[model samples]
Target: MAMGHYVNYYRLEMAQQREEEGEEAGVKRSAQYMALLTGPGFTGHVLALILFLMVTSSVERVRRKGFETFWYTHHLFILFFITLMFHGAFCFIRADTPPYCKSSPGSYKFVLGSLFFYILERTVREIRARLPTAISKIVLHPSKVLEVQIKKSSNQHGDGFFRAKAGQYVFLNCPDISAFEWHPFTITSAPEEDYVSVHIRIVGDWTTAFAKRLGCSFDDEQQFWIEELKNRTSNGVGGGEETISGVGVGAASGSSSAVAMDSMAFGSGASLMGGAKQRASASANSLQLQRPTEPTITLPRVLLDGPYGSPSEDAFNYEIAVLVGAGIGVTPFASVLKHIWYSVMQPTKIITLRKVYFFWVCRDRDAFEWFQDLLIALEEQNLTGFLEIRSYLTGELGKEEMDTVLMEARAAAAAAAARHFRNKHYYGGGGGDGADVGNQGFEGKGGEGDLLTKLHKPLGGSGAFPMEVMLGEEMNGSNETLSDARRDRDAITGLRSPTYYGRPNFDKIFGELALAHPQEHGQVGVFFCGPKPLGKTLHRCARKYKFKFHKENF
Candidate 1:
């Protein structure tokens, strides 16, 4: 709509210029147009058009590569609006100029109200940005993600602290980096916390310099380690047993239908690359090491502009919410997850959210190592049935291929077990303590009592969630006490939720959710912050399933 308006206005301006110049003899239209450009009204008209074109192009995908260009060009609206008003008020050219020119007609009346509102909005924003603010802490995570914690004092609110909802974003500016540059980042910290926080992925020049100012620069050795970590997943060095906690059994069952867990055992081939794997692991660890939170020197003064609303902020309004985040797009969901934890922890806070399915898709495990501890902690909490996390690693094998390979590995393991069964007496086999409970058919009822005895930390309020109840009636023969089952931890992050090897199947996931919640046709909310391709896929699925879809637009 905006583009069409701009094009139409440009065409009309050109036609009027031709018409005005055609009235004069021996004056070429091109030469006359250039001459008119130096005049007051014509100058503003041409300047406004140029500003619109530059700002429009920069705001597109071009911002990803050159954000400084986008930021500077976008702010030209101040000049563009002023020039627009000047172009209208001058009224240098007109139709039927004899009578119209006598009256000194202008477009100022048409634009005055909107221009006034625009100025008022910026004034309020400027005042809010100048409010008391200071950097509380800074941590550099893996993948060059910078976490900044800011403490703010607000005079307008009675609480005297800056307040912003989870899943919202803020525009940050540091005079030390560039006095005029401001970048937007999603707030990763919950509002209940004392300070506001934002996780910035250092992808642009502004963010890179910002990280350096905070003492997050990596030495040569550290940079070498980062390169090695990228190739670690494919060398067969990553391996871990898969376990399903009793609290998350239903969610596991639902996910297993779409994504299969990796069960491929390593051989001599993996051992040959042991040194490389260790170095990669060590590098990842070094990158994740805590930097000095408070520097000896004074920290740079930072200004914040918003507690602005985003689509993901509406997540709590729905009874069932599905959050899909890809790469750094997971930032908003981090805030939402923390908010959910706080809301559930406090009994006084009432919310409509009952279940949340969070899907985090990263290219590799190292990309999201910083988020692992949070997931592990959330898994240990009492809100077991409320939250289910699924992390996908798309760097190595794909989903379908990984499933096929796992099937082949399971068959090979079965053949080896058969050979060992015949020589039990020679091997001195007397082990039946349910230590290998998760290694085989975990959905069976054979070792319920023994597995329950082995579980040390049962999830939820009481320790009697009933393994049979979670596994359903088919596995319900034991009268033994029920507790949370042991989880299958991921080798990369040590998260209880096993990471899949590829992208998710939105159709299958949405189909399962639709089946589970028949009454929530329009009530089920699907909030996504990710790449455009995946977001479009989710949007289509939402329509097919009759669910509400909200996407985070930059």
Candidate 2:
């Protein structure tokens, strides 16, 4: 009887537990139903789509006039408000839903749909805010023929400039002009530097205007003068044929070489030339050069946003690095090389790098001259042995010229090796037999000391190159001898052959490199930043070579 009573008590407890579970499940379902009714998930998504169309239509109108005008201003505020409303509605819905709702089968479907809407909304916002609105002080401004280097403050901590990896870009806002507009520029300085620098070439209206405003000489002034003339006519100079002719002649003549030279001298040349000639004609009947007494340069308030690019960490693991740079594309490589140099040469650790080849293409001697100092320093450090520096002067460099340079460099290297072998044999305790010592001496005796030395010495043989070669050869030999050593002690486990080529036909270069270095399949990475065609070609080549390609467009 007692056992039956105990069994009944257990049965009753089980039934009660089941009832509680059923009630809890019912409560959850009710909560979910309430959430679906109140939440803006579907409703908000529809509203966002409507807002996207509205914003896109408004953009065309905003762009037609000016991005800073009332139409643009009103559109921006309206878009912002709509986005906020949509965001708030979605948040309210998410909050009201039970946590278990997230586990429902339909949840993933909803999320996928919501994600698309989110991306679209965010993208539109980015397009609207394309112009950065912050201001950064100009740190350094260096003028070059093709571009100007403008260094400015960064978002990084401390007074020091942010360290940007190779291929990264920053958006600059000149608040002094319009706070809504921002221009993109790649960082050209080394990553270790305290200040960031960007090399900007005058290109479009915005860039050209910015360059002119920054006092870089370019064709922008002429274009600006033309634009100013058009503006005046549109503003209703209400005149007859004579007045129109006067304005046309004035604009044309004002943009002439004389005006350009005058502008360069006075710095206010654009403004002065842009003013109606009638006004100037009344002031003085004579053509005269006027220089502004006050400084004309008004530094724009600058703002920096983003350091976007592929990460540079990939280069750190590379045993051999080959950097191919065309024109200003060399900027990112500069940063990469700098990082490698510092990381490898740090006093606290000993990380040996095998080789780094830099193939730089330029248009003239002046182009080479720009980075000449940096190249010289690298060469002096014997870094050039590991780092081969080759320059192709594309403007005047024909196939023959390029071939000649390559031949000369190769012959110079071979001859130096031969002479060094002879010297070792003659001097004793060196690595050669004394076969050519007599011949060398005889050649040296013929009043050809300078010629013999030149022929015997390596190209750029100011002692650094030979020392580097010797050390490199020794290291290579040591690795061979230590092949049987423990893996931890192996220094050359993954040594790669050096890449040497001059003005390789871009069409076949990728395929050739890929075929020869099949092991590079997963290990190699390619970076291209230059003319669109060259960049595209490299991208194709990278695919053929089975290399990972990272491209940064300017």
Return the TM-score for each candidate structure. 0.67, 0.45
Any residue pairs clashing in model 2, and if so which?
135-302, 136-302, 136-303, 161-194
Model 1 C-alpha lDDT per residue in residues 53-98, reported as the tens digit of each score: 6767676578888888877777776676567656644444455645
- Whole-model Cα lDDT of every candidate shown, in order: 0.60, 0.43
lDDT of 2 at 265: 19
Clash tally for model 1: 2
In model 1, how large is the Cα lDDT of residue 146? 69
In candidate 1, position 325 carries an lDDT of 93
User: Where in model 2 is the C-alpha error above 4 Å?
Assistant: 1-163, 219-296, 311-313, 344-353, 363-366, 396-503, 506-521
lDDT of 2 at 261: 15
Query: What is the C-alpha lDDT profile of model 2 across 1-554, one tens digit per residue?
Result: 33453354455444432212354643322323322343443444444555555566566555444434433344444444444444443333232334512323333443566557877865754553343222122211112333333344434454534446755777766654556666667665666665566656544456656655555444554344334433443233322111111111101111222111112211111111111222232332323223233333433435566677654435545555556678767777766766655664663555444555466765442344344435535654656456665454344333432333333333333454466565676656365455643333322223442212222333222321211111111111221011101111111111122112123454355554556556655655566666777778777777766677766653
Superposing every Cα of model 2 onto the true structure, what RMSD results?
A: 20.3
Clashes of each: 2, 4
